[model samples]
Target: MKHEFHWSQYLDTNHQKFLSDFKEFLSIPSISTLPEHKEDIRRAAHWLSNKLSTCGLENVEILETDGHPVVYADWVHANNAPTVLLYGHYDVQPVDPIDTWDTPPFEPALKNGYIYARGANDMKGNVLLLIHACESYLETTGKLPVNVKFLIEGEEELMSPSLPKWLEENRGRLTCDFIANADAGQTDKRFPTIVTAVKGALGVTIDVITGPSDLHSGLAGGIVHNALHIMSELISSFHDKDTKISITGFYDDVLEPTKEERELCAQVPFNHDENIKRMFGVRDLIHEDNYTPAEVTWFRPNLAVHGLWGGFQGSGFKTIIPCEAHAKLSIRLVANQDPSDIFDKLERHIHEHIPTGVKVTVSEFGVGAKAYTLSESHPALRAADEALKSEMKAAPVHVRMGAAIPILATFKAILGVDVVTMGFGNGGNIHAPNEHQNLAMCYLGARTYARFFELLGTDGPVDH
Candidate 1:
């Protein structure tokens, strides 16, 4: 099971071309959150399918999902070798606050050795690395060392609403020994890391309507209750003075962090003051006693209000009481917590707090993902650690992520396999304005993934 190979040297010479191709891939405005970009999402899927076919992957096709389509491809010729599924998403986050960006979010720009784009850091750059790594192996050796399958989706940013059923229906087509996820990032730009745990998510929209239509404040100021006032009260009711969730049973299923897990979360390198100033652009942050910012972010559950709207805005004052108020609320869940249960309790609590003369409605936005953890002793993780050491000359760091990736737990439940979420992108500016990732990191990631493919295929402990 051998062929001529020099992936690292090839990367050394062809990195500029790789960056150019990646820029082309990132140019598509495949914002899944916006319905207007459906064509763009389809274009991105076709583009990826073409790239995979060019790489000589068999069965390359665009499989339809209820929402945006999924791109699937594979090479399964390796006899008795471990099969690996490479997962990523082509759709990107909506570029809201577009005025804050120095350049257009969809337009790729190279500056300071980093590529500025919407999906550059959060995912698309890493996706390109996976594709090119597999392509490199096939191009150089004319065959892959293992059976590889790609299951890139188009709706991860939307909590992957259509993927669970798709996975269940196509389980036989996508069976694999383990999954390699390119969505998570490294501890920092300098060291490799593997994400062992991730927080789950529950999203809901709160709507309040107190009147039939907007009424003049002069006529309704004292007679009618303002919907915005009621909405503010409802939002405030979600938290107590101590800032913990006030809903009953919200914390019932939460698993408190163990001492060893807390220690691992602390091992991630971050300067508190610098991160506060540079990464978050805030003067200070709040946390309970005995927990660092990283611990609070990666280990604890928290609620946030993402969007609030219900009034008039036309560069001047409109003397009318808005009849309706709305807010977008989300909660991050820790291990053992169920998003459905939390939503049920939250909805009940909101109804309990509704004041007289006002009607409230709460509805979940997405299906929600569950929190998950992988043991350090997993052979797939050990193989990834060795790959990082071999390529970057440094041991990998194990850390938990604060983001919600619903598919991780689904993969474990459905396929009975754990995903190795090794990091490669820059940590700063994900899901924010001026999002960017280091091109050098992408190159290193390509080399590391190439080596990882070989490790998973030959003399690797993943088969056990």
Candidate 2:
């Protein structure tokens, strides 16, 4: 119970600088989804590279991919201890509906024990915590407890479109025992959560052309096929009344969850059905027949129409049959589901349903990834478990996220190491407006990171 946290002194001395740097880091609108923010993305990468250098990390380089850059840094002086590839993203999701935010999304605001900013939780804060945790050890003890290599990329918000090829191209330099992904988080402030399982994702867009141009509904309503209706029908065909994906072979590769695994999912603190209702302000939660809320979230696949657009805007009453319609869809996959296979099946289904007068086209909407689950006994997972228990005063909850990290599969398949996620984040508005991070939780995350390194190497969860 009486351990000297050597990092505590460094943390106390540099508290003000930490806040100042965090705000500056969050201020860059590195919205990866927007072309206009490319410069900001590069700015974020450079800023992070410099910050890593300042943290005593060696060989800091802004490694360029075909898309955005990946900032790499390392401190490999732990002498045969385990090496952890710490993964993070410098990019934040685009703050859509910007008018809904109380303050500007990029301008970080510290109020009510939270830091309100675009990347506050979904991960600029997570990246900074890793740097500070490493710095605390380097500054106080002149070395990290374990070797660490940072792989902070600039395109996670786009589901890491460039990471697969980029990771394969640089696998030799990134050889490690495991990955420490700062892209995930705890279920609540009361306890820590280890994301042992994460769902895969496949994104696609539907484009329908039913006519040459817009025509009056009175003239074209019966004669012409409506593009909007065509697009809607195309998406609607992916599901039946139960909302289960009805695509051919959609469930073919899905790995079923074990009885024990489902039980553990049921034990998690965050209730999926309840939170879905509360978070989205929806009155009813949809179900997939023979599954609990937790089971559906952790084990099953889902299809969702995330974005849709067609004719008729200003002040309504524009009675016209639009010539074109478009929609964006997101499909979440569980174990053993291949993104490519799912993508192929989805494309085939769309074409099969195309009406005689209409032409339908579909393209990959964004990035794709296969589902991933870490081994229960991975050393890095154990270290994270111990460190979280030491900090949170409770055993960490093991949970599966229905969302995709997109790059986790690439890490395992290409780099041959399972990524052990040790992020301090959550599901509350990660890609929505008014995004915020609990400053206290961020500090706790930093402390836990230091201890995890200690447990992974020569230190005893603290310094003398």
Candidate 3:
């Protein structure tokens, strides 16, 4: 079977136009986490619908969900070729601390070969890449080799709360042999990487109330319990000195990593501890005992306290005992661990750990997902490997991801399909100010997608 193709040169010829189009796509601040960008989200969905239609896809339409919209498009003409469902998102993380940016977050700025924008790296650039790749194939040869369908969504940054119901209602329309989860990218351009697994997730807010209102610190200092103090104790109960989650039954459902999985994890080129410490601005690294950060990253689960607040004031101390305290908590689970089960365990733990005077409530806020692992022999992965090898001139490495992706799990469980997530992202500074994408990687990803479509179609892998 032929792996390399010259048609990717189309991306080179139209690089300038691609850049302009990508900039226009990035200009819309479709921040899903905020309510004010509702219209912007709709605008992004419409823009994608038009772009998908012009890319030679048929029956393109804007799909509505309870929260945000999902853009659907497809071209399913290849009779024997496999139908590959492509996945991406138009929603982006909110650009906070807006002053630190060298350029406006919504304004695409090309500097030093990188495009600085809010959604440029996190995924709008990726969405544009495959669309143009499809365009290249259709405009050059008039048809695609394999059937293609797009499920670009607008609430990925919000953890896709409404995606479950939407997927359930539209399951028939989304039928396909495999999925191309374009939500992730390779860490290095030198050697492409394939993510084999991603941790599952559960998010909940902890609300602790000690009384109806605040009390004077002088009056309640020793006589009454402080809400922040009680909250701190509750949080402290969740972890031990070993930096392991101390919640009961937390590890009961965790799937132990196989020997081969551990060996492969060790071989990956990564400095887990040093890199993590640097990224988090911590002097030291701490994780589960008898395991390095790399081993624990993909193999073990993690419970983290993301936010905590009880009492505060302008400049000086408030000198009052705050009656209420709140905390945002997120837990990442490995394969075989269910988020709902974990939430039940967390609630039980909280009930057992709380003090007498404190009233605690655990409200599940974000979308929860089960852990996902795609088999290495899956045809979608094989096609991605072939495409990457053709473009990078080297074989790709497979690694497991620590982050949570709700769509991968949802599609796998509900639709009974596997997803291969491939990309050309360098993978840093996303979800923060000054997020950027390498312009070269952007076009390279487009070319890679072009090659992937050809390889999948011609080889007839994952055929129905």
Give the best candidate by TM-score.
Answer: 1
lDDT per residue for candidate 3 within 1-464, as digits (tens), equals 22233456667788998998899999999999889999999999999998888767899999889989999999989888899999999999988889988899998888889889999888998999989999887776778999999999998877789998999999999999989888787666765888888888888999999899999998889888788988899999998999889988999977777888788877776535776677556898777887888888879999889889988756966899989999998998898888888999999999888888679999897778888888888877778888889887778899888888877999987898988888776535788888988888888789889999998888885933
Better of 1 and 2 by TM-score: 1
lDDT of 2 by residue, 1-464 (tens): 22245886677667677788899999999999889999999999889989999878999999989899999999998886888889999998989899999889988988887888899889988899999999998887788878899999988878888888888899889988878898887767676888888889988988888877899999888888888888888878889998789999999988777889877877776766786577667898887898886688889999999988998977958999999999988899888888889999999888899988788888996667889988777656777888999988888877788888888988888988788877887435688898888877877888888888888895322110
Quote the positional error of residue 34 for candidate 3 in Å.
Answer: 1.3
Error of 1 at 435 (Å): 1.4
Candidate 1, overall lDDT? 0.85
Displacement of residue 288 (Cα, Å) in model 3 is 1.3
**Clash pairs for candidate 2:** 185-425
**Candidate 3 positional error at 306, Å:** 1.8
- RMSD to native for every prediction? 2.0, 3.4, 2.9
Ten-residue stretch with the least lDDT total in model 2: 455-464
Winner by lDDT: 3
Per-residue lDDT of 105-143 in model 1, one digit per residue for the tens? 988988998899999998988898998888777777778
